[model samples]
Target: MNKVIRIFIKDSTLIPVISIVLGLLIGALIMLLGAYNPIRAYASLIEKAFGDLYSIGETIRQITPLIFTGLSVAFAFRIGLFNIGAEGQFIIGSVTAAFVGIQFDLPWYIHVPFAVVAGGIAGGLWGSLAGLLKVYRGVHEVIATIMLNWIALYLSNYIVKFFLIEPGQQRSRILSDSSWLSSSWLSQLFDGARIHYGILLGLICTFLFYVILWKTRQGYELRAVGYNPDASEYAGIHVKKNIVRSMMVSGVFAGLGGASEVLGVFHYQTIHSVFPGHGFEGIAVALLGGNTAVGTILGAVLFGVLTFGATGMKFGAGVPIEIINIVIALVIFFVAASGLVKAIIDKVKKKIISGGSSLPTSQDWKKGV
Candidate 1:
């Protein structure tokens, strides 16, 4: 019992969990302040997220892209690089996938994978541009990536307008059935829900990320460089190459996210005046997940549930949907403050220990304190 308590106190995962719980408590308080019943609001949110087959499918649909973008940000973060242009990569990937989906006529097996590959390649190249700029020009990645996002946005918009746009429409041509990832059998199973195979693909990628990062020599090199580039360089590791590789891989995930959105849900690309917020939301997911594969998956799911259920809260309890956004923002804030929270927790634990507490005398707990 003591050992478990000590582990729980020191475990990194506990911070995020406690942060989420606190976020929910604050959300409930907000509901009360707004003269709304918190219980009904929460119940409604729960119902809409998991109450029925259709709701479950919608939650998964929302989770699909989140999983991809979350992984993209998390992968870059693991390399000690901040990738703020996942939105751009995602946009380019979607356009590329839509281009392939509409321009080609092939069998389903070939067409689907072909579009996916095109999206991934497009995103990878876009991400690599930032890396190249950082490596050769001494430009900061944050500035380079931010600029590239606009470039990609305008470039993709031009491509759509001049080349791929339908003659009578602003958006690209609708994708062919063969290029879609949605499954008829699965739709039927979910009572005509929009869930697709993309969720499974996201799960596969999550596992693959864990395997590649933990089991591959290249991954070790990337992590080592990220941990300390100067040290790695002195140790004869190709730090520059790893930086480029990490950015490319990060873009691949973002691009796949955009492709999944097009192939599984939207089935076409539309003109965008602004970056879709998915990329930015990914930063929150990566941070909350501590940049771990399993943690990212769980974080994405939590966001998915909140997103899918927010409308239900509005309708069922007369609570504003924006309150859910507030809740999410608070959760992110708390996650960002985990170090401070842990310190306070440790201080409180020490106070209890000095006051004749039943705490263990283990080195782990002491170090945590």
Candidate 2:
């Protein structure tokens, strides 16, 4: 089993190609249900997601937040912490970003990072609250984060209504012109859609996450603690401190997720409704992405395509948005039980092993190569 697992990780490319193929194959099976034409529904899905520049822009816009939240959730999972409060963190982050932008008048270069940091700090504090309770009071994070989400939601709504509300409307006041990320420059390729350069920022963050998670000693400790906290303690690691730090880092990612939306996409805080269920969907993105940062990015992009594609599934195939959900559910089912896929791979492995093959050993991973 260890040999097989090592091979799978080492061959990294196999997982992605397999995951996509399986998702589509299952989606095709659903189309055969007769209520909808499989070919047209899927064709419409493709056309809408990438058939035009406008839809591509929309896909990127929608995907931006998922990247941050997905990484946030995936990162926490690495440390054996299930960060269910990314939703709350996202809201809190967005509100703080709004507060900073509205309260200050700094230039773009300074203001943008400042706003993003404010959002991240707000989110980190919330995540820390849950971690603190778990570490000090024996509270389950699942309950604490859920409760915090409500608190954040209500508080954010109140802020939006009273403090951030636009002078004449219920929305937030328009951010300073310096804070706006969109410009006529982006119009060169994305039409009027606001797919700004922030996508690059998201990519940079994801890359950093990948590096930190796989290449750092602290990362190994977190993963070890996640798999078995007692074992990590035996190894002399401060388990509680690591837990708190893990949660804080998780919140930072969630906060970045919120900042990406407010800064990169919307340019203002929105009603909680606009961010409805994003943090939740991010869990699915994390899982489908294999709980790795790079995997999460691909999963998020795949999710974005499905979201943007499903509109055509609604219009051209007369299918409802619910079916898009059904499709996603089916894909998730297959990926979660990767054992089924592994079982199939066993056959190929045996044939190769018979060909005088010796699987890689742990020494390879320990090489720090």
* 38-98 per-residue lDDT for model 2 (tens digits): 7788889888888777778878877887888888889888888888899999888888888
Best by TM-score: 1
Q: What tens digits encode model 1's per-residue C-alpha lDDT throughout 129-220? A: 88888888888888888888898889888988877787888688789989998988887888788999888888988998898788999889
Backbone clashes per model, in order? 0, 0
RMSD of each: 2.6, 4.7
lDDT, candidate 2, residue 355? 58
Lowest lDDT block of 10, candidate 2: 360-369
TM-score of each: 0.92, 0.84
With a 3 Å backbone cut-off (N, CA, C), the pairs that clash in candidate 2 are none
Quantify all predictions' global Cα lDDT against the true fold.
0.87, 0.78
